[model samples]
Target: MTLVLSACSYRYGRVRPYVLRAFSYELPDGLTILLGPNGAGKSTLLKLAAAVVVPQAGRVSYGNLSSRSKEFRREIAWMPQSITPLPSLTAREYVAYVGWLKGLSRTDAWERAQQALRRVELTEQEGVRTTQLSGGQIRRVGVAAALVHDARVLLLDEPTAGMDPRQRRLFRDVLAKLVEDGVQVLLSTHDVADLAEEADHVTVMDRGRVLLSGDTGAFLVEAPEGTAPGRVAEGAYTALLERGEQV
Candidate 1:
């Protein structure tokens, strides 16, 4: 499934007419990342793609069809920046409930929940109350909830937001594996280092505008005379936004 944003614009009305006046993007079937600092319109972009918010103008489509179609919604999973599960529900039940809401049968939802939990490596904690899981585990449960529907596309906003360095690394590794399995993933993050070796493509945004987008290598900035060229996402972030200002 391909997610495309064609000249999309959105903003809180009665205030600013356009926080994202005419942003456009295309995501292929791989792990495509959105890189931007806080308030750079990253979450807004994801929300449009997820069909959580309708654009004020232009189009958001999956495979050239509007996401409003029930077929598309059933196949797409969205995890916003913050995820909260019912405190009384078990992790497995939480995932099953998501699948059920997506139109799966009771038996199918329960079956898929088990497999989804296993994929996120939460089998041991499936029976635990969601409120009792560690912060990271709860995040994984959100992913599992998304996966239980066997979603064709995943729109995750700041998936690694509160994780430590090691946790971030592990999450990145998991994303790589998902790519191998052919899941189309759109992930948003401000931490360029998170995409160092994982991103297949990158979109850089700032102040409600898309500054640059293409293969990850296209935005890389050459290292300074003294430092290594490693972790170029940081340099790319600066170059794209600063260069846009000059234009």
Candidate 2:
């Protein structure tokens, strides 16, 4: 599924400036990293794509599935930066509930929840109450909820925010399996170094505008020569932001 945003515009309030103004881009297949500074409208973009918010103008679609359609909602999942667990629900219950909300039957949701938890390496903690889980564990629960429905597209906002290095690697491995199953992912993050071998494409944004976007290799090529392999993504991203400021 190709998620595309066409001439989209959105804002929090009528008096406030638009967070995304005429934003238009087609999401590339596989995993694409969305990089930008604070208040760059990355979250808003993902929210719109996830259909969590309505676009004030233009359209967001996954091929023939319009954002307004229930099918579109079912085919995509969004994991926000914050995961506030509902009181008293265990991790498995929380995920299963989300699956049900996404249109699954109770029996199916329960079964899928187990599989999802396993994918995020949280099966051992599945019976733990979400409120008692650590920050990173809660984030994994959130990822499990997102995966519970077998969504074709996933929109993640700082999904690895509280994860340690090993946890991040584990999360990336989960993502790799998802991509291999032909799931489209658009992940927003400030951690450029993590994208070295993970990202299939890169899109840089600032102040509601895209500065640069292309395949991972094309994005890396923007950096100056002699850039260390580990620093190439960071270097290219910084250069793009600098050029955007100069524009």
The TM-score values for the models, in the order shown, are: 0.93, 0.95
Highest TM-score model number: 2
Residue by residue across 12-97, what tens digits does model 1's lDDT show? 87587577877778887788888888889999988888888899888888885797788777667799889896888999999999
Q: Rate the local accuracy (lDDT) of all candidates.
A: 0.82, 0.90
User: Over the stretch 19-110, how does candidate 2's per-residue lDDT look in tens digits?
Assistant: 99999989999999999999999999999999999899999999899999998988889999999988789999999999998889999999
Q: Tell how far residue 142 is off in model 1, in angstroms.
A: 0.8
TM-score, structure 1 vs. true: 0.93
- Give the per-residue Cα lDDT of candidate 2 at 6: 97
**Relative to the unseen true structure, what is the C-alpha lDDT of residue 129 in candidate 2, on a scale of 0 to 100?**
94
**Residue 69 Cα positional deviation in candidate 1, in Å, after optimal superposition:** 1.2
* Candidate 2 worst ten-residue window by lDDT: 189-198
